[model samples]
Target chain A: MSTVTLHKVCKTFGEGKLAVHALRDIDLEVGNGDFVCLSGPSGSGKTTLLNMIGGLDRPTSGEITVANQRVDQMDKGELAEIRLRNIGFVFQAYNLIPVLSARENVEFVMQLQGIPPEIRHQKSKEILAEVGLNGMEDRKPAELSGGQQQRVAVARALVSEPALILADEPTANLDSVTAEKLVELLRHLNDEHGITFVISTHDKMVMGHARRLLKMHDGKIIDDIQQR
Target chain B: MGIVFHLAWRNLWRNRRRTWLTAGAIAFSTILLVLWVPIQFGAYEIMINASLAVFPGHAQIQRPGYQEKPKIRNAIDNAETLAKKLRASNQFVGVATRAQGFALLSSGTRSYGAQVVGVEPVFESGTSSIPGLVKKGRYLSGIDAQEMVIGAALARNLKIKIGDEVTLIGGGKDGSVAAAILPVVGIFESGSNELDRFFSEIPLHTFQNIFSMGHSAHAIAIVGKTVEEQDSLLTALRQETKDRNDIVILGWEQLVPGLKEGIQVDKVSGFIFYGILIAVVVFSILNTFLMSVLERTREFGLMLALGSRPKRIAMLMMLESTLLTLMGLIIGMTIGSALVYWVHIVGFAYPGMEDLAQQYNMPGLSRLYPQLDLFNFLIGPGSIFIATNIVAWIPVLRIRKLEPVEAMRTI
Candidate 1:
């Protein structure tokens, strides 16, 4: 179980005349097994907030702690180690390396974890099947469809069994039906495997599957609601 | 490290066009450098050997000031003692003594100053390759007293034929005018014009008796067992002559400083040629690498997001460039080696340039043949790879500044 705590975190771009606040005084907490969805329109700083929580970006001010480690104080290499050991990411465009096969992509995170090849193979295979890519493990990303590639990416994110899976607009490019299926898959993993998932999305289909919804506007979380 | 290399390999292939272009640039530069090696060093070796063939040996033992002035006073007086010392040393194959002086040649109304050397036909011919350069008539022989062999240019300038008699006039040590009438037994052509037009060979006794030097000669020429043994031969000669107050020993290269200077000048010129080629090629390589880096920015960013560190990305780029340059170097060296081998066997021949070569009295043939110096060849390609790696760093510096989010979002 992991908890991401953000206390008065602020992010600013440039300095002086060109200073633009990307995130402002953001305090939030995400608990273990929580299916949290961050919803906002473009430039609402939702992605920035998710990146800060995932240790992909640092807050210009204040503190962030994830799974008991002080992320704000960690150097780049230390943060990378944290991400490798505890965090997984899924991008809107899937972010699957086109040159690698499905199983190779899934095994990439496990490789970073220094898992033995045999264990990585078995885990990758199992995760690929879990994401509905059973026989497509050997295919490269370019050879897979939009939906199938997203599934492979999802498999990659979960294969490491990270404490937190942070996805930025994970189903943004998929059709509604595919998006629904992906949201359902993430929600099922959270419910069944107790995997903490923080997804940033504009798709209503994704937010509807969230156990808790956080709304953002002008770099601030304006609303938070717990779904029945 | 292995993972970084794995991604580096794929990154190189991801943009096939850029990668190939960069590789081509590297290969072309490498070939240019490799080709330069043989041509530059070959010219130098040929020129140096030609100069040494006519004037110096692998090492020379002379009276202290004899090379500066070939008059009778500079002749080695204790020649028997020097010859005995030299012959005892294992470093020399043979030591040949000769008397060198200046003479004014006259054929009809035409006249020119010449450097005349009286040589012991057998010993001189054995020490140097000069006798092998004769293009017409026979070279001087042991019993051919009062007979002279003139260079082709000297023969042409004197308007003298093989059977013609030429007069050599010069001052003796006793203020007496020493003169001799000698029949030209042979005409020789040593390809360099400077040597051919100014040098003549006669029997040593005739010069020794005419100059009143009493069996003494200007210098002793020592030929080594092989070209690589020159230094050892010189060192041995120096040690042998250590107790002699009047004798000085010097290496062949030092005997002809002009030839060494010419080679150094040629080496510098050759570097300029390869430098320009490398500059053009390295610029293109830089361009290709920069474009490739830009194209892969998003991929790099994605990898970073997936937990690939910035340092890992830089390592990946560096490995890819190194691999590309190494491939280019290997291919270029292969092609260059083939060309070097072919030229070394067949030699270069310029049929119509014989007259031009004759005018210069060049020691070799009309064609400029390249020397197959393996060390020079290796140095050429090795330097190219080093240069490529240095040039390849331009792109890596840019990657080091890459922010993960910025790289991921780069289109």
Candidate 2:
């Protein structure tokens, strides 16, 4: 049931004279176990499109469906419910809470969902271990390195087992080697867990690991390539 | 709620110095309130007690117009019987009778008008402070002794001293010229200008013999455990002495008009002072919380984005404010109570108060004890706690308007 369908999505930033169109007319679909990368230059609507899919922002005029629920027409609280139950977001710079440790950060989403503590602990441990953070559960974000914190962020997104993980430039801060390792881990997670992933990034390394690539410029999608 | 508590408690210490300073403000207010209320009440109590100790006991029983007209004809003939009747009730602790009259006293070349009191020496100890306040000489010896204790101001005016012969001249009960020569035995200073200048005490039998009164008393002073019992004691006296048309009873409040009004003024001012203290502490707590919430805009947005209910975050802030205020309250009350207890044990006094009181002809201050009460202890902290939460809600409600998406964009 991990699915997303968008119909003629359009998003604008401001009203008439000073309006900045962040996303243009766009139609797209993603199925279960799809590793899709939205690759684009700066101000190219990739982040905006991902925000729409995750219900973090509303589109100006469009219809959006993720996990069989309408993301565009929902109210703020309803949108938050869908985002809480079905979608997980890994932001570019603000993914992990700075005050919480690795394990606490990973357990954040499960705690919000009213998950039992014992199960949340079990799932967070397993996910952190799966992301190569086996011995770093107690280290806070301030203590952890960029790559380790990003791993904790990824663990958080995957621990809830949401139908869709919307990550916006998750590897933009990590070095090339760490970034490659992260993309490879995401690929492995997609292969093994069958959760759909839609990542927006300008990093070529991220695009290289995707099975489908959608390139955008000036708020419009220019290329949609299914390589595999 | 547990997680919320954990986060809220930890958040308080994120700025430890600031948190403590805010709490310190509240603590300072609390300590002042706890200490000030008791001391104020104690001061009023000391004022009333000292003033009443000199002459007017807490309540008095006298013939109908003895205080207005101090003549031998206004004497109560059955004062002892009425005192015995009143003492058998549960209300009266001590009852002492006196025969008082006004006369001119002369010693060689000096003379002045004096108010003479004839009292039972042993029974006077329970009702008047004159027995305890005898300065240079001793009080009157017994019911049969021809001895007199005069006020210091009167002795100074007449140039009289211990064992000096002072002659009293006045009219007796039968309209004859009353005259007597008595040796001054003691001198008492009651610390009031008028009382020290015009009062004297002599043996009841000698005074009655000089005034030609046959076993008649002028006034009776009643003593009880506390002033709070005076009203009930008066009511009991009313019911007991209803048949005696010639006698009357009056409490000190009825005798002293301004004392109760002064106490009421102190109470009102105490409450207003405490209200200002609470307001200052509440504003300090609110200002601290508002700045804290404002500084965490991005962090709060992230929390909302992570699926925390807006109301829950507000409740968490409220919990933090409450905890902070309670911490201050505990510190303040502990220290305040300790200080109060220590002062109660050792007593509190000001330097040179005795001399100052004597110089001004006013009652001098001694060691004062405070009243420890429960309402100030509990309700004072309770009001501050509620006030802190109310002010803390102002900023958290503003935080509720934040959009997670916009918040994420904030640096």
Candidate 3:
């Protein structure tokens, strides 16, 4: 079954005089547990496409269905509910709320989902250890290294057991070795835990890890390929 | 609801410096307002009660228009009957009659214009503060044929003391001018310099004879059972005197409009201060909260995108502001109330200004015990609560207009 689908979608910003078309006529689909990479250079609508697919932005014209629900027409609260329940996000900046500790950051989405404290803690610690940062769980984002923080962000994404994980340039700010290690961790979660990954990136190193790759340029998908 | 309040409280500590500063500002303003209002209101209280003690005795009964003109013509001849009726009503502690006239009091080479009040000596002593404030000589006895009570300042002006006979010359009945000699009986000092300088008291019969009114008193003075009973007593007197269309019953507020007007001025000024205080505190709180909201722009977006409702975010911001303000209010009220209670106990004194107070005939600089009405405290802190709540919306409205994409990039 498809976990994400976008049909003839467009994203226009501003109104009338200042409007810019950020994404135009985008059609895509990703099945459950299928790891897909959306690779593009700057201004190629990679992040905008990812945002629409994740239900964080509404398409200017067309429909987006995620996890069998018409997410394009969902209200802000409904979109938030979808994001909280089905979608997990990993960003280039590793946007952890600086006030929360590592373990707390992993537990935050579950807490919002009304998961009990013990269950949240147990699952968060389990995921933190899987990401190879178990003992550093109490440290805040500022107290950890860039790679460690990104790992914590990845841990937070998977801790909620979301079906589709949207990673926007998740390795853009890290060194090649750390970036490779982070991608391996995401691939490990994808392969072992059956989590689907839709990664948006310009890095060849990131795209090389994708099982399916779609290339984009100037707001249009240029090439699609599948690997064994 | 409990989560909201708990998170709000925790958020206050997240910006400890800002929270503490806002609270300190609110608390200090509350303290100032609490302290200033009572002292201001207490001034009016002291003026009214002190004046009524010596002159009006809370209320008065007289021939209609007698208070306005107070001429010798509008005399209440049935003063005894009126006094009896007033006593029977059980509203008055004492009912006394007083006949007043403009007279020239002369002793040797000195002469001064004086208001000679003809009071029933025995009853007037208990009704008025004159006997209690005597500085020299014995108070006049009801049976003393030629006894008088002169204010110390008036006595000094005439340079006469007890046992000295001062001749009073005034217009008598039918416009005839008459002269009578009355012995100076005692010197009284009633704190108010204006009163001590111009007023004199004499036996009721002596004043009637001196003014040639022949046993008639110009008005009756009624004292209430207590300060709280003054209004009811005045109302009852007005009701009973309504039949005697020639008579008017006046509460001290109406009888002494100037003094009452002065007291009202104090009350109005107190509210103005409170208004100014609320404005200043409100502005400070708004400025602080706006800065905080501006700084938290991206974080708010993240929360909203993560699944918090727009209204819930607003509610959260409002909750935070209210929590901060309440903490401030509790601390402010504690400090402010303590200061108010201290002033009530020890009072604020304006030292070396006694002469100025005496010259203006205002309540002198003793310990100025300030008394506040019940609503003053409630309104004081309640205004801050309202102010912070209203101000919190400015940030909430700003956030509401933000698109999630734009809000996410605010950092």
List lDDT for all candidates, in order.
Answer: 0.79, 0.83, 0.80
Tell me how each candidate scores on DockQ against the true complex: 0.57, 0.41, 0.42
Better of 1 and 2 by DockQ: 1
Interface RMSD list for the candidates: 1.7, 1.7, 2.4
**lDDT for each residue of candidate 2 in A126-197, tens digit (9 for 90 to 100):** 999999999899888989888888889888888778899999999999899998998899899989999899
**DockQ of prediction 3:** 0.42
Q: Determine which window of 10 residues in candidate 3 chain A has minimal summed lDDT.
A: A91-100
What interface RMSD, in Å and to 1 decimal, does model 2 have?
1.7
Predicted candidate 3 versus true structure: per-residue lDDT over A123-209, tens digit per residue: 999999999997999998899998999999888888778888999999999999999999999998999989889999888988888
Off by over 4 Å in 3: A12-20, A74-77, A102-139, A144-148, A151-163, A175-181, A191-195, B1-7, B62-95, B103-114, B125-127, B132-139, B150-179, B186-197, B209-249, B353-365
Deviating ranges (above 4 Å) for candidate 2? B59-78, B88-93, B98-121, B136-187, B194-220, B226-257, B270-280, B353-365
The residue pairs in collision within model 2 are none
Clash counts for all predictions: 10, 0, 1
Q: Which consecutive 10 residues in model 1 chain B have the weakest lDDT in total?
A: B356-365
What lDDT is obtained when candidate 3 is compared to the true structure? 0.80
- Residues B260-362, candidate 3: write the lDDT tens digits: 7876776777778788888888888888878877887877777665655677778878888787778778887888888888888777777755654453333
- Report iRMS (Å) of candidate 3: 2.4
What share of the reference contacts is kept in model 3?
0.41
Give TM-scores for every candidate, taking all chains together and pairing residue i with residue i: 0.89, 0.82, 0.84
Q: Once model 3 is optimally superposed onto the true structure by TM-score, how far is the C-alpha of residue A16 displaced, in angstroms?
A: 8.8
Tens digits of lDDT, candidate 1, A1-228: 447889999999899999989899999999988999999889999999988987888899989989899999998888888888888888888888777789988887777778888898899999999999989889989999898998898888888778899999988899889889888889888888888999999988888999899999889999999984
User: Judged by TM-score, which candidate is best?
Assistant: 1
lDDT of 2: 0.83
User: B1-411 in candidate 1: lDDT tens per residue?
Assistant: 444566667767887887777777777777766766886677666666556655477778887766676566678875745776777765578778877877777767777788778777877765666676677777787623878888889999889888888888877655677687788888876656878888888887877777676767788888777555787787777778778877888777668877778778878887887878777777776777788788788887777777777776777777877888887788888887777777777766566766755544453645666776778788867776677678778898887777678888888
lDDT, candidate 3, residue B237? 80
